[model samples]
Target: MADELKRRAVHASGAGLVALYLLAAQFDLGLTWDRFQLLMGLLAVGTIALEFLRLYVGLELSLYDSLTREYEQNQFAGYGYYMLSMTVAVLFFEPRVALPAMLMLAIGDPISGTVSDDSLKFVKGPRVLVTMFVVSALIAAPFLHETPLAVVAAAIGATVADGVKLRIGDYIVDDNLTIPIYAGLLATLVLEFGPV
Candidate 1:
């Protein structure tokens, strides 16, 4: 059941991204060749570095160094989420991408975490996904050209991504992956392509 939700969540997120890209293409909204190059390069570098840390060196840097450790230890959630979220938000010109990504952190992480217990309540399986949808939509509103519609899309995207996290990302995500992705995708999009 959990795995199914994870698969569905990924499908949702992927579908949303495809929809957004199609919408953008229809509108002729796109980053220039330069931006795409930069983003891809950055993504490649980031991926390689993360693999090194994860496979070669191992988990040396603790999630504890991350502000997340405090919240994880005390089981108090949403503590540093906003600050970190905001920092990442500035990267992408597309509210669509930003919102879903943000929701992954804000809603998905805390809501699904074992914080105090080994299991979660509202385990209808959709709980975390639903929460991601709601929170991502709220955060994405003001950032998009079509604020209202984009918000809805972001929410949907977030929910889907959260559901897929376990199956797709498989917990390979962390600060290292986060940084390079942010720098690569968002930065390139904004710098190379005008704000979407």
Candidate 2:
């Protein structure tokens, strides 16, 4: 339980990036969207470099033992995928679409994790899926209120990402990577083509 809490804490810390992105803009800190995307890209690059060192160069860090799951020992960790997804979100989507998606990963995922059972399976339980949908919808509401359909779609996308574990050959796709991208893509599609 303590370890789970620690993992969730680290997961929730991703919200700090959202806070910084919003606060910097509100306070005129000159961290514009382009600059923020660049920053995320740099983070993704750094994460990839670290993952290469860990996977190929046989580098071992204590942080990995504490935070990563057993399955992640040989592959890229969730944090790497997380940074990559976040960078892709900001770079490809508008703020109205991206911010809510990011929040769904940062806040909604942690909440879902807390409510989930400790099963190392491919799919979460129905209760956890419901919780993820509700939380993700609420998180996206304020940002996507003008387009309620988009909000619903985003929530559904986020829920699906959290509920199911996708595998590409031997690698299990992390929700950390899928949640924001799915939500952002769904929201963007609705905003672009759906009736607002």
Candidate 3:
């Protein structure tokens, strides 16, 4: 069950990614579209093939599905997805060492939730998010150099993306595309265009 569950999520994520690929083509017209096929191949062959083999080994694939269902019910599945995505990204492609950037989001989420809910009223909502963002920046400063500015930019971008994604997905959209596109664009801008 677990293996099957993992395969389902992986397939869904792959399909979502393929949609993103098509959308991305709109941004860059006249590009030689060769690599897109490669991506599709990886999704259809690599990710699914490895998982299918798990069933032959007598491993319980249903458990993955069960856990994913549980996580969806509990509303904390984002953490698992994050971990899985990062691990796969690192192991498979080695692109976007954006852990520091994403950790800002992960850490800021709980902080924002706490203050926004008044559970930690001693600290203001915006302030707490900012402070967490700042601390994450400080921790990443040595490596990123322009840490403070980068963190602030990412926080603002993430906030806007989150809000916009919800509204956009609410009408004629799949919600799954939000975070990957969010992270992808943010990574591109920060790593490729940002002054830092």
lDDT of 3 by residue, 76-158 (tens): 34434444443333233212234433443444333333434435232335555465445544534543454445545544544
Query: What is the lDDT of every predicted structure here?
Result: 0.41, 0.89, 0.42
Tens-digit lDDT string for candidate 2 (138-174): 9999999989999999999999999998899987788
Candidate 3 colliding pairs: 1-61, 1-62, 1-63, 2-61, 2-62, 2-63, 2-64, 3-61, 4-61, 5-65
Which candidate gets the maximum TM-score versus the true structure? 2
Q: TM-score for each prediction?
A: 0.38, 0.93, 0.40
Compared with the true structure, the alpha-carbon lDDT of candidate 1 equals: 0.41
Q: After TM-score superposition, what is the CA distance of residue 60 in candidate 3 from its true location, in Å?
A: 12
Model 3 segments more than 4 A misplaced: 1-71, 74-77, 84-97, 118-132, 146-149, 161-165, 169-184
lDDT of 3: 0.42
| Top candidate (lDDT) | 2
By TM-score, the candidates rank as 2, 3, 1
Residue 94, model 2, lDDT = 97
Model 2 scores a TM of 0.93
Model 1 spans > 4 angstroms off: 1-54, 57-96, 103-108, 112-124, 164-196
Clashes of 2: 0
Tally clashes: model 3.
10
